[model samples]
Target: MNRMTKTALVVATLFSASSFAGYEVQLDESSKLTFGGYFKVDLRNVNGDQAYRDYWIGTSTYAPDTNQTSLQAKESRFNVKFTHGAVTGFLEYDFYGGGGNALVSNSYTPRMRHAYIAYKNWKVGQTWSTFMPLASIADALDFGGAHVGQVFIRQTQIRYTNGGLELALENPANATDANQSIPDAVARYTYKGDFGQVAVAVLARTFDNNGVAGNADGTQFAYSLSGKVFTFGKDDFRFTYNAGAAGRYISPGHNPGDKVNTDGSGDLLTTQAYTVAYRHFWSEDWRSSIYYGHADVEDFNGLNADSDRNHYAINLIKQLNKQLSVGVELGNYDADISATNSANSDYIQLSAKYVL
Candidate 1:
């Protein structure tokens, strides 16, 4: 590469559309901006005792002989990032805000997914929780892929990171009780090597009852260990193990951090969950993933709430190009209301996504 050729390339890039191919714009020497996200359309169908159109955990009324199908683009999202020196800001949104008539126009409202700013080792605002191992989540067409036992959440927080260590003080509203004077605290450490990556995170928080019924406040603690291990070629194994009071972190409507007893004392429920997934590549453009997740809560079963939850899914995805792909997934969700009662639903999803 000679100086003349290098200069020509630079000049061409500055004036050609390729310079902004990745939605990148260099405003100045010290500042740059980029925008990226994906647009996706999903065709889904469910069969069995559940009437829901999505992959939901927990118990529902057992409506036998029911089947439903839906098509939507709610998973489409957009994100923008700006970096100036040591400071960077990012904002993201998806169409899951839940406004629209499905039968009329299928219109939906955009909802915030992530809004945050990072300066050096500090991050502030809303984003994926430090407890979640985003890399270990399964690949599936459903929005909640292998979510039954997964620690999945996004909230406002102030976080600090050094190397693989992350510490955060997150919003406490997601606790079992709404009234609280303290934030949820989390600490995590991650390790990455040639084989794969692993992370361990712990969360501690206090839940308070605002004297509504004279209930006492309580403290809860939880932990998660997750990892992705590379196997042969592009194949890998992903897993997550969690213990203690998962509460809303595992997925709302299913697990509660604590329950108030007749004595007005909070009784923290012990819970455990695990998820395992494997991804195998058949060819350069073809891949398949299979995952299973299970969750159990001790002695906290309600008539309509599940004491146990399980999810199983398998998907085959084909990459059409650098920015386009399609996939199909089959999954099942089981929620146990009690020893003898349970709801089971099976779903199939087909999706196409375009990245930008």
Candidate 2:
């Protein structure tokens, strides 16, 4: 065949294969293995409270009086999967592990983010909490982008999924040095349609502190409804509404809804959160995401009173290629402690990420 014929055949083959799902496979059929994930370097500058910047973005309350700038590659992560017959195991890790500061010694370690084994529709081990819907997350630059109104947790769990129904029994989180008598239970239902995706989750947890003097066990319930809509050729609009003890279960650190009261009692604090975000594509290679999240905290026994907060994030991303992309994000967080005392934090992050 002529050189032109060869080029035409290659183009045709590429066009035909574009519909395949993106995944890489290695190893033989007897013991197949797959590896994937990304390498990311983020250059972040904080306008205030340099002392409190966290591996995860600091909430408004963590703000301090200092301005700081740092260069970090902690978001870099990878995952490995092994498949043998009907059983499969997977492990993933990232460099956000706690140790030294990103701006200081930079002696952080790589920590396990996910480790699980799956058989058919059942999975066991630590992974994303069942109380949150990953499908509703916005494609933003922040590690978790104002994860205020979202359930962002990972724990050891035994989960089963069938069609749209997913259920899990997760390790109890005894935050108050209490002996957990029971495990946390989570259930989620997700539906996918031509329009987009919708998901709802329910969580039940038991909290107890063995210590006497107001140390009591409490059972609380939390739930959430999240959905996503696609528009403008693959752009996504996402929203989530969460209420009840879901704060401790989903977004434990984002705000003050850690638990109810300060007495090591099991009483779950009441909180509500709402988030809305939209991602728009200006061109095939460029996109932007705008998001706003609000969380309300009701003071209980002076346990936590950073009060309610609103967070906003905006970003513009450019895809250099399938494996290389870069973006910049700006985030603002406002805390309403009272009418007279309010605090805010601002941040700008520039990142370049290569995924495989």
Candidate 3:
């Protein structure tokens, strides 16, 4: 019985007798091993006219919530998937409980949102990315109002797909030092047809300034392009777009000394981003979407040193049956700080979900 438990009981008795040996188990061709989950509880109200500090939750100043309500568990998830033969595997867990821009945390803190392994179209570990084709400004419950150019960063990659092309090899999260010289490489390409889907990405990094100190001499290069489109009730309706750019190289003791320019002594910065979205379903149990995003950061001395951000969102989903659902979201953010100050923030959410 040892030997790895007899090879997992002979692979679970050959996948449960080849999943019923015939054509009567058509719940998507049986051979499945699935267990789903979803639970959300949120009631939030935030506002701002001036006070809005949350800098990823370090919150030093800026507090304005004339009508605040708190309770969170926004991401209570559990998912397990296994499909025999052509191979597939997945694991997901999130218990939501943390601060600093919450992605998931349950104090015991075990965050591995998804563990992957796939075959037949190849894939390996960590997920999300075929370059990330914008799904109409996606909103799986306003994870910070979506659209951070839609590339949810869960790296550790190697992938290939056919039937509309896809290729990837990524691992870019900025090697935050250990003798910095960053370039964790990342590449992506994707294309899917029927008038939708398109993606392109590239990242070569080194800007883990987390250790501050003259911002660690900088160095970052990023590029991205994203897409999505759909017209009329085919999948209900959709339209989406994404754009990106990031460039930096500041060596020379982090430049910036009122030196309005420099290229050899090193100093150049650029950051531009964009996202647009629209979706509508209004049937089969209702749906809705609307999105917008923008970012700009430029500084190479030209004293106007820049920084600007904006986001907008709207979502409503309802499915009240066969696993339940209800959601509502609203969002806003604006920042233009270094040009005579500007700040704004807004949020509202209500959610309920249950899915087995």
Candidate 4:
């Protein structure tokens, strides 16, 4: 195919809801191998007290006049897949394992992003949680476009999917350090059509404090609703809303599942998060996206109780070709700890990505 045809094909594939993309090889009549992933580099700077991170985590406190700038390629990753008959195995990794030095030779560790096996309608091993709506995620230059207001997590599980319904039993230990006597249960249903797609998922988990004194444990539930609606030509709107005692599932490291009370009783922190994003294609090679996220936590046991945070991001991306793209994003974040204390920060990021 010609270069223009190749680019168009790649773009169309990316916009599709399917997860199969990349180079493929036929090892035999019934066996196949695929290699995929992307190399991404980001240059970012943050100004103010919100603290700088590869992505927003809402851990910044009241520190003022803080500023930092850095460049990193840790977001680059690759994956391998092997398929034979009705069975498939996939493995993927990224360089977010930390322990890398910034002074010289930024050597970082590679961490597993996914490792799973699929046979028939069953999926086993580590992958994105069923409660997360991947299709509702924002499209932007930031590592996590709506990091502050989304359910983002990955863990080992056994899942079964039939049509639009999905059921899974995931590892609960990853969500809490307390004694876990049962796995996390999740159920999701999605509806897809030419117009767009929508999904709803529910999660149930048990938190056990190992009978420790002054620690409380119990069972809690969470729910999420997400969808992507196509609008005008090549434009779409995506959104997701999550609520309940989601804890780490709400937004890794930002919202905790529960807190210990003075009397040793565990209190499931109530958390709610939501994100809305819109993407408009200026042309076949140009596009722009804008997104906003908000998160709230209540009934906590600290001075920062009832804390909340919000963030906004906008970006313009240019597709150089089928395998290369560049984008620039501007974002702002704010945290409201209490009426007497609040902090905010602004950031700008430039990123380049190449599909392998």
Q: Estimate each model's TM-score.
A: 0.88, 0.84, 0.30, 0.89
Top-lDDT candidate index: 4
Model 1 C-alpha lDDT per residue in residues 26-98, reported as the tens digit of each score: 6567876677888898999889876665556543567777788988889889898989999999999998898
lDDT of 4 by residue, 1-356 (tens): 45576566545556662453466665667876678999899999999886678888645566688798989999999998989999999999999998789788889999999999999999999999999999999997887777778998889999999999999999887444656679999999999999899999999988677767644478788999999999999899999999987877886666553454444456567789999999999999999999999888774536446767898999999999998899999999888755568889999999999888
Where does model 4 exceed 4 Å of error? 1-22, 213-216, 260-267, 301-304, 337-340
TM-score of 2: 0.84
In model 2, which runs have C-alpha deviations exceeding 4 angstroms?
1-25, 49-64, 100-105, 208-213, 254-258, 262-266, 300-306, 336-341
TM accuracy, model 1: 0.88
Model 3 backbone overlap count = 0
Residue 266, model 1, lDDT: 60
**Model 3 stretches astray by more than 4 angstroms:** 1-30, 39-46, 49-82, 89-117, 120-126, 129-157, 160-202, 205-296, 300-303, 308-334, 337-341, 346-356
Predictions ranked by TM-score, top down? 4, 1, 2, 3
lDDT per prediction?
A: 0.81, 0.75, 0.54, 0.84
Residue 62 miss distance in model 1 (angstroms): 3.8
Residues 1-356, candidate 3: write the lDDT tens digits: 35575457546654775322221111244355665666666666667743532211101123444344555664667676777778878888775434434355424343667788898988888876444544544544565344433333455677777765556665543333342444345566657688876666665554444544444345545566666767778442333333222332111112112121234333225555566667777887878777776655565324566655666777888988867788887877665544565657776778877665
